[model samples]
Target: MHFLKAATIAILSPLVSATCTPWSTPGTCTATSSSCDFYTCLESKSGCGPTGYELGYALPFCNAITAVSSNLSVNGQAWYSATKLCLQNALSVEASCETSCTNIYLNAFASHVPCYLDSGFCELSGADLKVFFQVVGVAGVTSNDGLALFGAVLQGCVTKYQNGQVNMGWTKWLVRTLNGEI
Candidate 1:
C-alpha cells in the first residue's frame, strides 16, 4: 500500500517528463525547412540551463538490513519521514555547493543509519556505488564517517541518473512491481 502511494506520486510529478533543451534565438529557422530554428536547436541540444537543474536524494529511515525471511524490515513511514528531510537538506546543500564551487556538478546525496542487529560496518561494507561515481568524477559524502564509504555507493547510484540517465525513480519501480507490471 505504501509503495502504491509513492508510485502514484511519482507518476504524477512533472519531474518525470521534464527534459533539458539547448537555448536558441528567435527567427533562427523555419518549421518546414531543415535550417536552424528555435525548435530544431532545442531538439539538437539536451543540456541543463545556465543555473543547471538540481538533483536530490532523501534518506529514508530504513533498517540497514531488510530481512525477507522474517519480514523484519524497518518501518516505511519512519523511513519516508527521514527521506523527506534528508532530500530537502541535500538539495539545499547542493545549491550552496553549486554556487561556491567551479564546475559544480549539481547532485544531491544522503547517508543514514540502518537498524540492523550487526554493526553498520559489517552489514554495509559491500556497497558498490563508489566505483560508479568514480567513473564520473564525483564523490559521495555522508554526515557520519562510518557511512561515508557506503554513502558514496548510494550517491554513485544517484549520480547514475545525473543529466537524466533514467526514466523511472524508486517510487515508480515500487509501483510497477506492486501492480504486477514488473
Candidate 2:
C-alpha cells in the first residue's frame, strides 16, 4: 500500500501543483513575488521616455503577439498590428495628435483607432494582449501610484484570466477604449 501510494503521489504531483504561465496583465502581476512586475521594475530603463516608465519592454511582447496572432487566427489583422505598434510605443504614445498629455494612452488609443472600423476587432483572445491594454491604459496614470494598490489590481486580473473569467466583454471595452469612443 505504501509503495502504491508513493507512486500515485509522484504521478499526480505535477497535476496538483500546476501553475499558470505569464500573468494575465500587469495588474494581475501586482504582488511582491509576481514575475509580472517587469514593467514596474523598469523605472530607469529609459523606454518609458521622459515620463520615467518603461514602454520599451512592449517590443518583445509585441513580437511574441505578432506570432501568436497569426497562429491563433486573430480576428482583425490590421488592428492587431496597430495595437502591437501602440504597445511598442506605449511610453510616449498619446490619444490623439491634437491632444497631448504625459500619458502614452492617448497615443496608443489614437494609433489603434487609425486601423479600426465600425466593427473591426483586434485579436485579444490571448492573455498577453489583454494585459497590454490594461497596463498601457494606465501607464501614465499609475506611474506614480502605490505599488501595493497596483499589485492588487494586477493580481486580481491575473487570477481572473487564469480562471477563464475574461471574455469578449473586456476585449470589446479595450477596442472601444482604444477607439476613443468609450
Candidate 3:
C-alpha cells in the first residue's frame, strides 16, 4: 500500500508542478491553467522588436493585453488600453525609422509613465501585476517597483535630452500628438 501511494504521487507530481512556457503563438496558452498567469505567458519567445515589429510582436502583445484587460474592471481595462496604445504608437515610430528612432520612441512611451502610475495600473495585484512586468521584461516586480523602473528610465531620457546627449525633436512632436496637444 505504501509503495503504491509513493508511485502515484511521483506520477502526478510533474503534472501538478509544470510551468507553462511563454506563448510563441496565439492560443498556445490560456487562462484556465492554474499554474500559469496568462499575461506572463504572453511574453514573446522571439521578443517584441523593430525587426519583426507587427506580426511577431505588436499584434501578439496587443492581442494578449486586450484579451486580459477585457476581463478586468473598467478602471483596469482603461489602464491596459492606455498601455497598449502607448506601445503601439512607439513601436510604429520605431519601425518606421529603425534604430535611429529608438530614443525618441522610448521617451515618447515614457511620457505615459505618469498616466500608467496614476491609473488603475497601480491597483493591479497577483497575476495582473505579473503580466505587466513580464511585458516590461523584468517579470515579478510590485507595482511600485515597476513604476519606479519606468520613472528611472524616463528621468534618464530627460537628462540625456537636456544635456544634448540625444536628439529628440521627433519625439517631442510624437509626445505632443499623443497628448492631443498637436
What is the descending lDDT order? 3, 2, 1
Clash pairs (backbone) in predicted model 3: none
Q: What is the lDDT of candidate 3?
A: 0.43
lDDT of each: 0.29, 0.37, 0.43
lDDT of 2 by residue, 1-49 (tens): 2223333443564476433333222322112211223344332322355
What is candidate 1's lDDT per residue for 79-114, written digit by digit as tens? 333443443333332222213221122222212222
TM-score of each: 0.22, 0.27, 0.35
* Model 3 Cα shift for residue 8 (angstroms): 58
* 1 or 2, greater by TM-score: 2
Cα error of candidate 1 at position 130, Å: 21
Q: How close is candidate 3 to the true structure, as a TM-score?
A: 0.35
On lDDT, the stronger of 1 and 3 is 3
Pairs with steric clashes in candidate 1: 29-37, 58-87, 59-83, 61-79, 64-114, 129-153
Question: Looking at candidate 3, what is the lDDT of residue 79?
Answer: 63
Residue 26 lDDT in candidate 1: 33
Candidate 3 lDDT at 16 equals: 67
lDDT (Cα, tens digit) per residue for candidate 3, span 1-182? 22233334435644764333433345432332122233233333323345343343335555666556655655556667666544434333232332322233233334344445444344444456555545546441335534554555445444544555545443344345656999
